[model samples]
Target: MSAQRPKILIIGGGFGGLFCARRLAKADVDVTLLDRSAGHLFQPLLYQCATGKLAIGQISRPLREEFAPYPNVKTLLGEAIVLDPDAHTVTVRRPDETEFVIDYDVLVLAAGMRQSYLGHEAFARWAPGMKTLDDALEIRQRIFTAFEIAETLPPGPERASWLTLAVAGGGPTGVELAGQIREVATKTLANEFHSIQPEEARVLLFDGGDRVLKSFAPDLTSRATQALTELGVEMHLGVHVTDVRRDGITVTPKQGGPDQQFAARTVLWTAGVEAVPFARHVAEVLGAPTDRSGRIQVEPDLTVAGHPEIFVIGDLAGREGLPGVAENAMQGGLHAATCIRRDLEGRPRRPYRYRDLGSAAYISHGHALLQLGRVRVSGYLGWLAWGLIHIAFLTGVSNRVSTVATWLASIARPGRFHRAFMLGAADRPEQRYTYSTSDLPAEGHAPGS
Candidate 1:
């Protein structure tokens, strides 16, 4: 290592971390990016993967491949268990459970948030969140398998249970998942089943808020809700889930009503997320204040209040009004890199100013919702914008090409043709397990943070 070169350690490979490493490639510093996952995921399209509109390879690229052109950048797969900003050292645990210490002159904490089951961490098994490749794969399997199971079962409570799909949280993820799931069941798998009419599947999007896509404008939210309803998704607004059972979920209407039990064999959680357990260590070690969500409170320069050399970006940073979206993470990462570069030259570090590129949710084939500041768009034009933006933002050209090809095929097919409800794994449904309510911290992230 050169004495003049600073050792920069970035603790994630999400949008923010990857871009940060790229921005620092030619800065004459060694950049080591550590993530538990092997690839950098294009998270905005994760809902597509969950709905079978895309394959894993279409939305993720190997982290090593992303930095191969830059000799100064290195990628490693490991869980960051501990962060010591004062000591300028991070303790990483490898896949084998072996721990190693790495010292850095500057540290960037882009470690993203993990899927939160609200207060019920145990609900994860019944309904997986659409965050990581594994999460999406599990959902796709569970969903398709549900149809197959429903086909085999007699027309009874069990069959009805198998046909029910519940999506918790009407945010972008839930909206996208609900809409696509409706499309798959109603349009894509229209003729794939025998005894079961896939269109009969009861798809529900339940949210505690008054409307879906609460982050978007009211008009846009209303349009998204209408789109979901037209596609046969039941939008149950102002409802809070109290318990998640293997057979279904129990919820109480937030507006005062008797508790209700919705029979859903599969439920997907898109409700909430907290920072990784690692963030708690940062806050505890630094006496930094974090909200109930456990994100770190950082200075405007994206560093801990008193720890100037330590930067927290993405979902981990508790920036006052910043949304927990990909754009904020990307901006935070780039700004942190800029600050590091400026600091290297004995200059002042610049504050991070997040720019919202807007929030969007994909609604079925030719529908979507886009919100950028005061502007709101929906319907076919919105879908085009959504498709173009996601394709353009994919990690690499290959990913983009593959996604384009995938989209083209969907256009050419009946829809979600990825599965034929074959007599394979779908023949044997996964047994339901008892979900626990213990609030355990999240282990690692699936890209977004």
Candidate 2:
């Protein structure tokens, strides 16, 4: 072994990457964390931002600031495009469209997952997925704009269509998003509109699965369904969405029935997610096997089976029928870090054993279902537990305090929806200024010019 410390490169700034970096802070390794975004986003609370319950800045913190205490760690703002495992080099595209290469003795691939439309890319133009801060803000705009448009429509189906909101998927994200929307409509937006009562707005929660919160116990699912129903949300279970378009969505029941079409202005898809493209690149580069979800098949120690030096974690690493949750990603990151640390110190590495911390889903208004092993709690108490646990798990004191204050304010007044929409001048298609990390014009250049 060389006398110099090994250089470690982590490809993500999510839960997995963040945890691994923190764990290896004191180790004799040079750590470099790379991500396209400048800050670390608390993903679980992204739905709140979409619903205007929280702002985008409230749920994110600067990545450099978070890792500043550890002098051995460095943050790079760039997107990794190619990973040459044989050469131990990573090629990344900087914001200036320049490619940079970094040599790494150890690499952790945790690029994470992105929204999967299942071969329906066209649907993205109308119904956006909640993944990044921009996505959340765009959805928030669509939601608030729906109400704004409804105020001008005559009282009829046209108005109802404008007030209607449809959410596809019944997983934790969809459930939490639907619940937050219900609260916003019934509470925050109750008296805001003149021609319509936001409380009567139609919020549809659709799931192809047989029930919501499928990962939870059956009893908990039943309770969640009941709570959502009480909150006036129309639950469509076991229904496959046939088509999603700008107008609406068409669905067919799983039991073989007539197709049902609903006309709505806002449609949100949280149904499925697939591993980011980097995972496939890694698998192809290493000639390693991967599962159907495009996640690399790693060993028990969270390292690539054939190439032990390369580690894969988070949603990009596949385990047999394992649910890709934040907890799983964190555990995988820690395991990979531990393995690397042990190898460096000439110690035996421990296999990763996932501990099920249970699952919780927030249902309508102030109710929730929590399953902690044999213990299951429902209703208000469960909601309290859920809030406390989430608050505790949130990173940084500013985010925690801001989230708590937002929750308390929502509970106290419940009609204060922060409206900060700025409508700019209209422009032609060619003149439209689209904002994205990958595509931005030069500092002084006009969008169209």
Best by lDDT: 1
Model 2 agreement with the true structure over 379-422: per-residue lDDT tens digits: 98898888888777777788889888887776655543555654
- Give candidate 2's total backbone clashes: 0
Q: What is the C-alpha lDDT of each candidate?
A: 0.83, 0.82
Instruction: Give one digit per residue, the lDDT tens place, for model 1 in 46-139.
Output: 8777777777788889999888999999899999898776678899999999999988988898889999877777777567887788787778
What C-alpha lDDT does candidate 2 achieve relative to the native structure?
A: 0.82
Off by over 4 Å in 2: 415-419, 422-424, 428-449
* For model 1, the run of ten residues with the poorest summed lDDT: 431-440
TM of each candidate vs. truth = 0.92, 0.92
